[model samples]
Target: MKMTDPTTSAATPDEELSALVMQISSLSKLALDMTKVCIDVKDKLPHVIAAQAAKIAMAIPETGETVSTPWFEFLDAPTPEEMAARYPSTNGDGQNYHVVCAGRRPGLYADPDDATAQVTGVPNYVREKRKGRFEALRFYKAVYREGRAFTAIDVIVSDDDDE
Candidate 1:
């Protein structure tokens, strides 16, 4: 059968078939590239998780404190009020504050447990302090070993221009 080219309005079945094949080949290559990108991300997933876990571990206190409740199972196991009291003000600026986890600023509160309304509202509280700007007190957990037991290291975030 005779075939006509749609774009050029010319009868060239061989050329049309060749063009279609090339287009298909290009699409296949693109799909392969995308698959590779996905695979790369998947391959790095474990490392990312491990890094996050390490950070959390570092945030705990070195005293080897443990909590009975699952809610307070964090490293330091500080209550919301305790955290607020511990860091009453950032750099003693006379502004009361709350603690939030690291990630985006103003960051999300690190309250895994349904502690209190103040803990839940930490993000909003910080945002209000910054006049609607997002900010957070990032905490990190680390582990150091002397012999057998690993000592927990509490890493507090300091004010930096990079943040």
Candidate 2:
């Protein structure tokens, strides 16, 4: 199919925005279609093709760079489940806390401007420091690309741990 050059004049900013919205809609539909195909094929898909798809899915569109840190290196961090296993869920006073998933922000909720503050799956961290023990929130580098989609997960050491 012949692709239109995005640089071509759209006449107005509203027109450009509309075009962008349509493009996004098309992309989303294509992604859904692709997902269906992948589900149907599953194990039958070739390793190389699967690898390329993974890379594409994890890549930064502008730079074509993988958003995730190296898998082996990321695996070095302690997962959220591991952290929960090691740490006490509640204090002696009965104040409950949990390793809640978050993004860049140290809090459980994402900041309006920081998209990376949104959490997805289980988060991981290098280690919880002594200072972090006393704080209400602690942010960690996300190990997986999807986890990093917004940023890092937070270990919320507060009664508000609702994740």
Candidate 3:
């Protein structure tokens, strides 16, 4: 971020605020370019297809029309993180997309100590964010060693929670 003195500048106070807004906008765009893939899309499409196949193959037949098409994919609702990446970030201070703890009853959790569970692919964070309801984001510092990824977490700050 560039630092500028308001004292000497001919620009008005409103102009300075606007300048700050523009800088924040640019920073957010750059952040999206850097982290969109891992945050926005994490191979959920493949899983969707696989789940559909499992559904169709099961003993109980689905009454809905047999699935097939590009259109069908769009119907699969995009996650809020995906929307956040694609949608413009008005404020640069939104939240980190990676290492999200969301789903049912989202909150910080103690690192799981189970070795067998660790061997199986499991995210340390649990998501409780309901579909169509994106509450907040969680940030993390990660370390990979001994065939596992460990993280230190920081949750997005919220006023609603305080209320």
Candidate 4:
């Protein structure tokens, strides 16, 4: 395949990096919001509300392709060739790669947006999964690139992955 122009591919790596960084940030924010909801109220947050927030909070990133859902089926979604044109693979660094996340809570529901939530053979990596409810109503991010891929750099969560 013909590689994208340098100016075009130049932003690909940065986009991937930005995606991963935002993922970590989002996970942290979700955990924080859930904890806040738990502490502020006497009861657990409603699943629908939590679910909705989760949808909004967890966003799948796009470089050229659009994320119909945040988690699962990134491949099934449509991509504008012009958007795909922006990403040219790095020699080995995976500069133009993509990202998806799925967390399995005991009450986990299949979100059209969740990638890991949909597949069984793949691990849900519940260590990082958020459990129970959100207070914030708006939990969505728009199409953009993360600072890095989820697996590319270090992520620091306050609690243990299983906690």
Candidate 5:
């Protein structure tokens, strides 16, 4: 059984089989290495993608200007006094005059007739006074009753620090 260079000399059956086995073994190892590399890449892909996205977000656009939506302005919370002034009561009876419901329940609607109506959920507000300044934290639901108005009824105010 002669084992010579495959390109130059003819090899015996046993030699050919041995060469084929060696090639298969080498190819198997290469395939395993490639699989490991792919696995490692897959594991790190999310972080790499996130970093790239962050970079893209921070980067200036080709037009050198950034665009924003106007609706985002509504998300800003107005001061308590400002909120009251903005949503004045319609009727002469100023019972719940600029009341705004600040409850956590979503899709909760406010009633215009009853000031203390519990339709959606209990209204909740947190009032804190520091250094003679009072700050009230609550959510306001704007309703279109007797014109546009804000109501804070049915909301509960938690004054834990009130002595």
Candidate 6:
């Protein structure tokens, strides 16, 4: 953000745009630094940022002016330990099942519906050893599921019933 003001600079239109981009990049870095220092805000950062982006989009009065909002695609996939910490496994009917997503009907469970209950070709032993690498990530929908630990994609939930 330590750049000369674009208005002050007698630069071309392209140069002015470049300066704006730089300022935006600096703001993003500063936001990221804040997240690193603030542990409590990390979980809520994505939602807050998205809201701001949406606000910016709405503020633009120009017709067909598309405002690109940030996506969780940049974030790294959650580690096994992170998965366990975020969504711990729940024991039910003498079987282990982790409530990965919240929905009317029970979403994909940790153990798949198979004789061996292996998911994504990963054995249960390795999954357990890793603390839930395959077991948690095997469900593709879980990544975008409500209350997921790691952000992957945004999902619009129309169902209001919480079972």
TM-score on alpha carbons, each prediction: 0.33, 0.21, 0.21, 0.21, 0.32, 0.20
Candidate 2 residue 155 Cα shift, in angstroms, is 68
lDDT per residue (tens digit) for residues 1-163 in model 1: 9776677777389989999999999999999999999999887676566645654553443476763222211232333344346544544453323333321221223342322333332221112222211232222111111111111222344569358
User: Considering every candidate listed, which one attains the maximal lDDT?
Assistant: 6
TM-score, candidate 1, is 0.33
| lDDT of prediction 6 | 0.43
Error of 3 at 83 (Å): 31
How would you encode candidate 5's per-residue C-alpha lDDT over 1-163 as one tens digit per residue?
A: 8577768866689999999999999999999999999999887676556534533433324475644411111111344456546544444332223233322212222343343332233212222121211111133322211111222323233567465
Put down candidate 3 lDDT per residue, 87-143, tens digits, no spaces: 443454334322223221222222333322222332232322222213332221111
Candidate 1 least-lDDT 10 residues = 140-149
Candidate 1, which segments miss by more than 4 Å at Cα?
1-8, 60-163
**Candidate 5 lDDT for residue 69:** 15
Candidate 5: count of backbone clashes, pairs at least 3 residues apart or interchain: 13
Q: How many residue pairs clash in each candidate?
A: 9, 4, 8, 18, 13, 0
- Please identify model 5 stretches exceeding 4 Å from their true place: 1-10, 61-163
List all candidate RMSDs to the true structure: 15.8, 20.9, 21.0, 26.8, 20.6, 18.4
Put down candidate 6 lDDT per residue, 1-163, tens digits, no spaces.
5778776866799999999999999999999988887976776678556645543443343587553532222222344445456554554433444433322222335454431232222111122211343454445234332223222233344458454
lDDT of 1: 0.39
